[model samples]
Target: MIVAGFACLGPLVILGEYSASMLTNQWPPTLPLAVLAVIQAALLTLLHRPLTAIMETRPAQAIVFFLGSRLMSVYLWHVPAIVLLTGVQLLWWPMPDPGTGAWWLSRPIFVVAVLLVVWAISTVTKRWESPQPILSPRWPSDAVTVIAVALFVFQSLAISSYGLDLPLAVLGLVCTAIAVVLTGGSSNVRAPDVPSSTAEAMPPSPR
Candidate 1:
């Protein structure tokens, strides 16, 4: 659906071929799509086994909240953070902008930063919901902090160096190593167990 939506607006993005037009026009078949999405969501909500299974996964809730919180966080403070960081960088390093030819650098930095931010949000949320109560107060675990900081620094370097920063890539790999060490393995964040009644309604595998 998303791809189809984008495809409907592909001509606008390709540029030079189409005249400037209002961005709102890009929302092709908006009413129908919106109606379909709502209907799908409503139908899914009404389904028994699938909906129950969905609610049973801790990771699903964690992901939904993680993304929601991160988006809200960005909405709350991104402008201020950007302005403050830009000021600091300008005053301290005074780096020149990477020209159009090397503009590909911007995308990786953006990608890394958004990924790190989302990871941070997910980690913190998992920590908050940890089965161990005492550890909850120590929210946003050291592992999350270390990884987020390392990724941010690597992204900043990549942004400054126009995709030619070998050290940044190495640092990213090192962060991955540290994450393994800290978590011992991947965090198995699952939603709390579903009721037995919900489970009973699910179709059984064929014997």
Candidate 2:
């Protein structure tokens, strides 16, 4: 359904029915947006069983675990990697007609290049996305910090949107860097120490 939503997104944007600003400036959700949300929820609910079943299988579970490890890296780098490689491809090869066999065949090269770039980047930043919790103060704070960091990272990422906006891209890079620093520091923050006097001040428990 995510893919379906993305497929429909372009048309809606082209029709001037939606824009990122609507997400920010619009206070209450419009009927159309609400309906779309409901439809998306229903689609996910329908797919839940099949998705759960796939995860239950050992081989699929292993594949999932592997993918989850580098999911952040892949998501972050794929857009830029594809865009970079696509430009190079356009220069190197004659343009193929859209939806043609030649165009379809050419895609794997871009996909491979993206994957390679993602893997290379993972070596540097994968620790930030590690499942292993660093010595944060408490689980709650750590979780909130992680979520904030992830959200920032997501906003800082590129999806090969429209024309390249160098200023926005640079802003995103700076934001992502800030997230990385926050994440790293928060992960190591120790919980506040309880004094021995405070422990002793508590009423005695009944034996």
Candidate 3:
């Protein structure tokens, strides 16, 4: 299955690139992309066990945990980091024409700069991603959870549709705050226990 999945994935990727290049006013070639998605899902199903096994190693677990802890911060800040880096480059260096050799050559440096900036931002912002221990006796009710989720989804869609103006930004913030407050208090939740030997083997996560 894994071999078959790789065989399928190679051709699917090539087809996807071809389909992407042929794109016109249409944002995506829906039919081809949909077919690609279905094939990718099948490939995942075939490859999941092996992938899971590989990710279960100590080194993989460390890498996963490190990134997972700051996942949200990375996602939120990466675009801003890219924008900042582009601004810096524009100010300090000659702006290369798009698709030119100079532009292509500078991409690796831009990528590295963006990553570094995002990493620095994540170190501070990651605290927000961590869940604080909730001491409240009562957990969120199902109705409350549903309402919070609905508000979050609605606000997200509104922001996406209208773009992030002050009103939509405020609405998104309010929805996010409400969702956090609604979901905040749960008692008796604890981290999974690791064996002492495994715990000893694991490297300390940087603050």
Candidate 4:
């Protein structure tokens, strides 16, 4: 039943993105918004329990453990990695039209190249994508992280709006790197001072 609901609403919301009337009517969020939320919640319900159990089991444990630290890296770099891929495409296929013979011939290679590039970048930068705990509870690290994320967001918006600008792209990348360094994402970095235990989920603590 939930799956059916999602299947029905998902298509309409996807198609509605092209509808100017829908945009105007729901400047912030329209029917599509509700539809998408319903779909997401439904899907999460279906997957959450099974995924949690699998992640905890013996077979999947090792893979899950490896991915745990790199989650942020994957999220943070995927967009810019894709943008970088566009530049890379130019080198191999000067004429990148979809219908062109060159494009057809090179499609598989391009896909593989993109996957490899994203993977390489994620591995190299994973350490720096997050801040580590400091000796004395360095407080300023939080603000630096926020600013770094802002820079990344700005770069993503700029790239999406007017295509890639190399200077801005580099600036965003540098900002994240600096943020990581400031947060102690290096050999000097230490894990956050908090105990490495999973406490039961609870409401915000007064302390």
> What's the TM-score of every candidate structure?
0.31, 0.53, 0.61, 0.53
For lDDT, candidate 1 versus 3, the one ahead is 3
- For model 1, what is the alpha-carbon lDDT of residue 105? 57
In order, the Cα lDDT scores of the candidates are: 0.54, 0.68, 0.76, 0.66
For model 3, residues 109-202, the per-residue Cα lDDT tens digits are 8888889999999989999999888553455667777877998999987765556678988999999998887776533233446799999999
Best by lDDT: 3
Could you tell me the TM-score of candidate 1?
0.31
Candidate with top TM-score is: 3
What range of 10 consecutive residues in model 2 has the weakest lDDT sum? 155-164
- Model 1 CA deviation exceeding 4 Å by range: 1-4, 14-55, 66-71, 89-101, 110-207
lDDT of 4 at 15: 71
* Clash count for each candidate, listed in order shown: 3, 0, 0, 0
Instruction: Give stretches of model 3 more than 4 Å off.
Output: 1-36, 137-147, 161-171, 178-207
| Local accuracy of candidate 4 as per-residue lDDT tens digits, 1-207 | 576666766576667653444334344456666666787887888899999988788879887767776777777677677678887666765656766887888778767776777779878988786667644553444566676567667765655555446786687678667765755453343335454354344356667
C-alpha lDDT (0 to 100) for residue 44 of candidate 4: 86
- For model 2, the superposed segments whose C-alpha errors exceed 4 Å read 1-39, 97-105, 116-128, 131-164, 179-190, 193-207
What tens-digit string does per-residue lDDT give for candidate 2 at 127-206? 87886754534433566577667758565344233223677667676766777666554555545577999979988977
